[model samples]
Target: MSGPGRFISFEGIDGSGKSTQARRLAAHLEGLGHSVVLTREPGGSPGAEDIRALVLEGEPDRWSPETELLLFTAARRDHLERTIRPALEAGQIVICDRFADSTRMYQGLRRAGLRVLVDQLHDLMIGQEPDLTVLIDMDPETGLARALSRNGGEERFESFGNDLQAKMRAGFLDLAAEFPDRFVTIDGARAMDDVTADVTARVTEWLA
Candidate 1:
């Protein structure tokens, strides 16, 4: 249980249950005697949390994809500087609910040519990737329905509807293919306990 810290990230279309899985993984690791830090993007640190409110609330068009990209990047930078890096340096397992991949899909795929911008800013400002990324795959329609039911005031992205969810699902799968070494895809459209067991098993294997 003593070694270099591991950084784990969870990603999926809205309502894919990545957040729940991420939290479960963190607690599971902690119960196994590993130090764990469970955090989230767009709002991990104080400054980044402030930015999260700005980008994740209001109308769907509250900010253009470009502006949203910038906001996300800025928040990520702050999160890295103030939260992630420090936790990693202290040799704690860092489980993040979402990371740059979310930005790549949500903002990058919203419009053509935006993915290039997403990568550029990511390389320039963040330049960091998690050691492991768990992508929870779920049906777009089902995911959208679940998201809408949340009524989580921060439903800005979910407000975009099923079209975006479908696009994001495909994009996330592509990203998994593109980064096979660190990405693991799991079915999120199952019972929560089933999904949690799969995630725990896969992540435990990685840690081993």
Candidate 2:
């Protein structure tokens, strides 16, 4: 990891298949002769990994939104210092799964009555924005259904009202609209291979 380069992030809810897409895209980039660093938020670093376990375990509802935001930020700062920044400095492409936008959706807006707290904490933390953020927008019901099929139990967020999840999905779309250049919205309902193909194509154009 040597010269300065680009940083990319993938954002979505539990069932959106962001991790799969991220990994596929990384491999695609590597095949094209680019050095790539694949990582994730809240646990890419050693300290972040510890926090990640706590943050994701039990239930997202177990912790308050403000507290959740703090935990995520703590992990993010460490992730940037330990993993992301180093790869970027070395001219490698860094692709992260579920970055700050997840916080904005889950902790900030999705959690009832935490919008203000989410905003304040968002500003305080998450200094570095991704050069490209791929938001895999999809229906909450379908997404949750997929998640449940893959994993047995429903977490705190999954048990939330449909309205909240819908709003979160919309929030992702709005974020993309607000940052047209930096955001790419893909059809997350599609098959994994299709989604990965679209992502790789988008990144290819961006690289050129």
Candidate 3:
């Protein structure tokens, strides 16, 4: 835990294959002799995972937008302290499936004025952003279809339906534009190998 390490996060709607790409990238980097830590937000460290269960389970309206944001931020703080920072200090590339960006889109966009709250909370609590964020861009229809096919209980966000997914897609795109230096937007509709190749190239170039 002494050297500079890379931090990367994958983001997209529920079924945009961001998680798949994150795993693939971790493997690819490891194959190249890099130490990689593959993790996810809302749950990465043990404490965060417990919070994830609370946030992801129960009803969609289980918590107010403000309450949900606080929960996510708390989980994120634990994750950063227990998982991300230490791994980065150890010089291992940390590839997270999701991070604060998901909270920004999920909670921020859920209400009209909540985006400010999400940003303020993040700034006050979780100040780290990924060195590189791979955003898998896909149509909401396609993404939702893919997500629903999985048939999992973690459907709270997915249950928000197509319209919200579409907005989330746009929000992600806006975030990419907002942080051009660190964001890599990739088309997720392509074949798996093709998408992987694109993501690999971007990360490779960044690592160079």
Clashing pairs in 1: none
Off by over 4 Å in 1: 1-3
Off by over 4 Å in 3: 1-3
Summarize candidate 1's per-residue lDDT along 1-208 as a digit string, tens digits.
2137899999999889889899888889989999999999889999999999999999988899999999999999999998899898899999999999999999998999999999999999898999999999999999898888998899998889888999999999999999999899999989999999999999999899
Candidate 2 global lDDT: 0.82
Candidate 3 Cα lDDT to native:
0.92
For model 2, what is the alpha-carbon lDDT of residue 138? 80
For each candidate, what is the lDDT?
A: 0.92, 0.82, 0.92
Count clashing residue pairs in model 2: 2
TM-score of each: 0.97, 0.90, 0.97
lDDT for position 107 in model 3: 94
- Candidate 2 — which residues are off by over 4 angstroms? 1-3, 111-119, 152-156
Of 2 and 3, the candidate ranking higher by lDDT: 3
| lDDT tens digits, residue span 24-118, model 2 | 99999999999999998768989999987787768546887778888888898899888988888988899999787888888778457776676
Q: What are the per-residue Cα lDDT tens digits for candidate 3 across 8-51? A: 99999989999899999999999999999999988999999999
